[model samples]
Target: MKGSDPKPQSYEQLPLQFQLYDCSAGQSDCSQCRAVPEEYGCVWCSGTCVYNQSCTSVPADTCPPPQITQVSERCSVLSSSQMTCPTPAVTPEVKVKGVWFQLDNVRVHYETIKGKSFTYYPNPEFFPLNREAPDAPYRFKPGGVIAVEGQHLTRAISRQEVKARLGDRECEVKTLDNTHLYCEPPEIQPLSVDDRSELPCLKVFMGNLEVELGRVQYDSDSLSVVPLAAQISLAAGAAVIILSVLVVILMYRRKSKQALRDYKKVLLQLETLEINVGDQCRKEFTVASFPPF
Candidate 1:
């Protein structure tokens, strides 16, 4: 038991048939025998242990997100076009059956055409009428009801018509191609409201007669006959013109003042120089008479 290597311990001495146990369930295991559970191992086991032998459950596969598709078309007729009438040279007539009030600066004429109908002719010459015609025929047909309408008919005659009738006074005519026809008319300023109010409702001026056709009441406070934007623009233009005039006047005054000041300074300098030269000549003459050194 000492230096003779003490008899080597036999398997029986080391408990060759000792109880084997599963360590996973805290069961005791033999130190020398092999009775391991499915994947349970002992502390002395050298190989890799398969503790979790059951396969893991996987999630179901999902589909990818949907993609957007674009569609193209050509020459498709518009729904509005299909619903509306085709563009024709002769537009349909618009009937304005109501009481008509014709007003000018001097007089207001009311004509009630009971049960009358007029064919709205589109005259290209009457550009601002919003009607397509210049020589629109307003036939006062029978069977039309009328009501009271008021206001000055300022747009009875167009500037072009006035120019044509008057043979172009200080006015230039612009053609369809933007070409200008220049003719100097006798200078006639627009009549003021007061002056115009004194004139007859229907008057002839310079061989051109103006008649009041109809009047539409316009509220200066609300329903803007002339848009606020346009009025503001006109006001801005006027203010700019006034400011320009004031600047020119101020510049002219400043230049004039500067010129006057410069002229005075030059005159003063000339007078001083002349006095100084005279005094020096007198001193030289006095010195020459006193001594010839």
Candidate 2:
């Protein structure tokens, strides 16, 4: 009876299972569809979906912490050539965005390679060595070059931050770099001889810090500089004039001697003529004395 009751079966007689949807089949093979790893898989797509296989990941940004290194400068001098004198170090401090940093730190970078040995210091490319200032008397002259070396010159990294002073007078910065600064000393017209002010000292300021480079030697106006070129020209001109005068005198003397010789010849001719005339007269008198015998 149970087998023949199909038409009268209630809803409870239906099968409990439903057909499962094949997401990984019918469209493409599982090998071709490729299963994306959970780490990079997208949440909106089904686990077998190929659309979420590629994901874009952005890296987080980080700032390198500040580092401090030891610096041992042998000396600081106005001239780069002269490092013999053990002078004080020029330690300049700069304020950037309300934070202060040493010039040596900001201007230089320490680099180390993974497999390499020695530490590398990346100095500014334009940094100069063998720079020397105008010596002594010349350094006191206007527009004289004053070379500043052995210190970090680019503290604030701008033209406005680099400043130089020769005594109280401000100097024009001609060339600047991390290690060297070339400046034109202000035209210090020397005070009168009665003025007793000492020569100005060369001072350079990187930011608010100051470094005394050297003192400009006093140049005296009393030291008469006789121009050798002018003197030589004057001597040559005088010699030429004297030689010309001597030549003129020699020519005049030669003309005078020639005139004297002509005058003597004329006198001798006159004397000979007188002698002949006298003899002729004597002959005529003798003939007359004979009385035509």
Candidate 3:
């Protein structure tokens, strides 16, 4: 009976058999003919087998699957004991697409894949933008100084770098000595739908300072450089204001001189008229007194 119980067979009792065949047509009793089929069939086998007639093929090697790592969406809030809202996990496949920052210190980081992106906002609502809480116990002004620490900061970052990276983001930079630098984006026309829908932008900050490297903007249309124009307009406006002020001062002085001259001439004419009246009165009194003789 061929194992009627159908129990699992041991290695020694297995039905598997290995045999070797002579590869040479003329050789009948060669050592190659006696090679084991199971041993020499594949390169992984332990024994030799026929070169062509018997199994003597090599198998390919395969590697294990790749591993995936998870990135945290929520960054730690400085000095706050409470943890901020949970953020979505960032996958290796995700790429930074667009970035925007609020007037407050809170930063919003965005990432995208296949034209879709995710936003992660940090806790601690920034000031100036949070006007609703006027009497709130924790009122922070927009220009207050603050210090930040991050993984990649070598030195303090300026407000210009932050604006460049975050695109119209507003923040206040403070030195250790409490020197404040207010950075606000210039007011410009609104972006079109195409500009808003363009590829995602990323703004990375190390502490309070912004990272200058790896910053990129992918606008479909040409970049509208406005700094030069803004500067020129500012300069022109200042010059006009200064000139206007000078002209006003000069006009006021001229008017004051003309009024003073008119006052002096009126005073002199009044004195001359009083003297003439006194002389006429004296001459008429003398004539009246002599008329009786």
Candidate 4:
């Protein structure tokens, strides 16, 4: 990195000076050169005192913290209490009963085969995952950010290393963390019945490794979006049904208890009347005994 004919004279051209090192200006200090923070895309060459950076090998052993170089939409991450939600970090996880599964996070009811597992190796590299949720199908907004999650990923891999595609449309993907990659999908074309082309593939590639996440199914028909009012009405209907069932059960129990109480009261009255009749018979029998005496 050191040569006499170095870079521009912009206070950056200086040679490494030692005890006997003397420049044309008889200077032996390199402090002024080391303070420049690479402001002009070039910093002080490590071993040399010149600012026209000639150090080609960057020390990979030490790395600075990562920073977001683009704008991002916000996402909530499940974290311990008091931790804040990360901005634009979106890798959804699935919760089943008391256990958590590292599967596609689609908000819908589904049943999976217990203890099922499968493996995939990236073929020529790219696997983009698409999960279908039940209820009313939500249409994808073109240019909206979509999150793809993977296991055992690391920050060492840069966003440039991964490539994502929806069908043939290239999705600009950005890595947010070890587990999530965000992509902006292009406008999608719905499939038609007459379309004989193979279903469009959603894949992410890392060099030559490719994982087949799934296939996209487009249709000429569109799903009807359920409005907020209809959803509220459905919830109210369910509540009404549950309340009616509880009321009927309470009424049945009350009727049974009333009948039991009435039967017990009648039995007590009949016992009292039988005792009175026995007393009257005893009085008549006593009179006959007196005449014999």
Q: Residue 151 error for model 3, in Å?
A: 19
The lDDT of each candidate is 0.36, 0.52, 0.42, 0.52
**How does model 1 score by TM-score?**
0.25
Which residue segments of model 1 deviate by more than 4 Å?
Answer: 1-226, 290-293
Worst 10 residues of 3 by lDDT: 121-130
Comparing 1 and 2 on TM-score, the stronger one: 2
After superposition, which runs of candidate 3 have C-alpha atoms over 4 Å from their true positions?
1-144, 147-226
Question: Can you write out model 1's per-residue Cα lDDT over 84-116, one digit (the tens) per residue?
Answer: 111112322222332233233543212333344
Candidate 3 per-residue lDDT over residues 239-263, each given as its tens digit: 9999999999999999999999999
Clashes (candidate 1): 21
lDDT of candidate 3? 0.42
lDDT of 2 by residue, 221-272 (tens): 5334669999999999999999999999999999999999999999999999
Candidate 4 wrong stretches, greater than 4 Å: 1-200, 204-208, 211-215, 218-225, 288-293
In candidate 3, the residue pairs with backbone N, CA or C atoms under 3 Å apart (3 or more residues apart, or in different chains) clash, namely 41-55, 97-200, 97-201, 98-200, 98-201, 99-201
TM-scores for all candidates?
0.25, 0.28, 0.27, 0.29
